[model samples]
Target: MDVDFRSGCPIAATLDLVGDRWTLVILRDMLNGKSRYSHFLDSPERITTNVLADRLAKMEAAGLVTATLYSKRPPRREYRLTAKGRDLRPTVQAMCRWANTHIPGTWTPPADFMADKPG
Candidate 1:
């Protein structure tokens, strides 16, 4: 399968990879050390199981995340961010900061929410 490009712009190309709404949320959760499905489900947005599964599959295909089996009894899997995915931290952080500043709200994340980590 091939990607359908919206435009020749690099931003559009980048979004083609991480464009889906669920994908970014999944990435955000992974950045915050959320590795398990249950933990992802406990997130503020409360993603549905089917959507979560689909997003995981897509992320895995895009080399953004990797899944490892943590259990054999029920065949459970845990996901972690790959180096490529970790590189998205800056983009996500910038977007979050922009939203916080432009969008009207008294909400703010913790000081270390976007700390300098060697990812």
Candidate 2:
């Protein structure tokens, strides 16, 4: 299915592709080195299997992620971010910084965490 963009603006175009909470969460997990299905499923946030599966497929279709079969016997697949997905690190970091600054709590990410990392 084809999904039309929200507007001609670059940021709007990007949100059209990678928008939605689950999609962004999945991308964040992938950026942090969570590739396996179980790793994503076992996250403390507890995303449902169907939602995870849908997000993975959508990300793959959008060229943000690649699915690879790590096991030949059972044909198990793992998801990894492509260059397009990796390029979104700045957007994610910017969102996190904004949240940290605007939100009520004085929440600060770890030193080595991506939110604190240099672009």
RMSD of each: 2.1, 2.6
What is candidate 1's lDDT per residue for 1-119, written digit by digit as tens? Answer: 24577889999978988898788988988887889999999998889999999888888887888999999999899999999999999898888899898998835655565777644
Which lDDT tens digits does candidate 2 get at residues 1-65? 36588789987887788878788888878877789899999777799999998989988988899
The alpha-carbon lDDT assigned to residue 86 of candidate 1 equals 92
Q: Which runs in model 1 stand beyond 4 Å of their true positions?
A: 1-8
lDDT of each candidate versus the true structure = 0.86, 0.82
In order of appearance, the predictions have TM-scores of: 0.88, 0.84
Global CA lDDT of candidate 2, please? 0.82
How good is model 2 by TM-score?
A: 0.84
| Clash-forming residue pairs, model 2 | none
For model 1, the local distance difference test gives 0.86
